[model samples]
Target: MRLNTQIQGQGFPIICLHGHPGSSQCMSVFTHHLSQQYLTLAPDLRGYGKSYTRQRFEMKEHLQDLETFFKEFNIDECLILGWSLGGILALELALKFPEKVKGLILIASAARPRGNHPPISIFDYVYTGLAGLINWIFPSWRWNIETLGKRSLFRYLIQQHTKITYHYLAQDAVPAFLQTSGFATDALNQALRLGYNRLENLSQIHCPCLVLAGECDRHITAISSQETSDNLPNSQFYYYSNTAHLFPWEIPQTVLNDIDYWLTQHPEIFQSN
Candidate 1:
């Protein structure tokens, strides 16, 4: 299955993978920023965004698609940057095809993602529903429930996931979250149930890796992200305070700088390619 992919820039390939309930569009910021210095490829995994498929698929299928994506693009070696669920896929890719992956840049993602992520509560459902209604009714208005209700829903969902109040959500986040296909969302959760852990096997992936985490992340804890780095044979970890899972969106420049610095440190990744 050939996924719908976004390609940019003109140097060593750097594949950017999005999180669960996300599409290639979600990784546009990274693609645009890195495109100037690297070849950035962002693909909408099967069942998400423009690649939506009715046939059931899990992480295993997604991995197969990515492998095919590489062959389709004549990509023999590339750096990978993954966010949330995409990070898990990157680890799997590096493990399964170590020769193809030169390095990794993981953001707000975990190798051993929790199998039992909290479900959206009734309150979340109510608020999200209200927010939708409000947005529909006042499509032109920006200050009403469109802002308040959507932000409230974001906070509630994050609280359910992390038991902490996430103070901010970028305006784009709401639309991105809403655009996710229900089928894709359910498939990811099912994939998680089937298992996505790589903790014990992490040592097998020896390539350079840079793991970035949000200290205030509501979904994945900084410690968990750090643990992923710790288990890897060659990896570095960094955490940003007062940031949440969407820090890449909240502070795009900072995240980009961090990635740039790490890439500079591992010049071999590009030089070898």
Candidate 2:
């Protein structure tokens, strides 16, 4: 699939997946801490970042690709950390291949396809659509990180580490975000048509689960996280104070600590199946 990936640290394999328009680099905050205890593999999902895409995007195909990636590393069982849209993929993976999943960690994930969400508002929809068109005309408009609601610290780090210019907004960032959002929407709609839903499949997941949500996130409310926890037979939930949808980026240490503690309490789960 020619996915752009970065592998660091050395221990049990931990696959980190980013959300829409977000590359693996989005999770770089946790690389140092996670690498300290486990091998970390973060990949830019196809159609985002440097990954190659053929035609249409398909969740099942992407899942299959990930399964192959795991097999290549001899990772029979490992932790899966997915954020936002990546969280959806994480749950799908666990559902489709429970034996390969050791533990599941979801950050700011939706329990099901949402309706009447803030981002779906008419203003945001029109604004984002216009912003996308503007980006198309002015590819260098992405440098304005302020519009992205990024904290100063995050903005500084991204500017210092990557060449993410304003143009990236129009050329890659914004479009990717919109595209993936649409992809998720379509997938969710199809699931509904097929009489399947996230809540409906939650009982099928037997793996230990850790669900984290941002206290201030309007996109995926804390209610979703709580419901996910309630649905999973073996799950624990935490809500980060003063955080938004970007909880992992905002508090990687806290998240890592929780994961470490959880794994410590469930060492038996990590053993080969």
Which structure among the candidates has the greatest lDDT? 1
lDDT of 2 at 65: 77
TM-score of candidate 2 against the unseen true structure = 0.73
**What lDDT tens digits, residue by residue, belong to model 2 across residues 160-235?**
2122334334444554554444444455456446642488788988888999987766656777777888899889
List pairs with backbone clashes in candidate 2: 139-167, 140-166, 140-167, 141-166, 142-166, 143-166
lDDT of 2 at 209: 91
- The worst-scoring run of ten residues by lDDT in candidate 1 lies at 159-168
> In model 2, how large is the Cα lDDT of residue 245?
64
TM-score of each: 0.85, 0.73
Tens digits of lDDT, candidate 1, 70-124: 9999998999999998998999999998888999999889987642335767877
- Candidate 2's error at 70, in angstroms? 2.1
What is residue 156's positional error in candidate 2, in angstroms?
A: 20
Error at 100, model 2, angstroms: 1.3
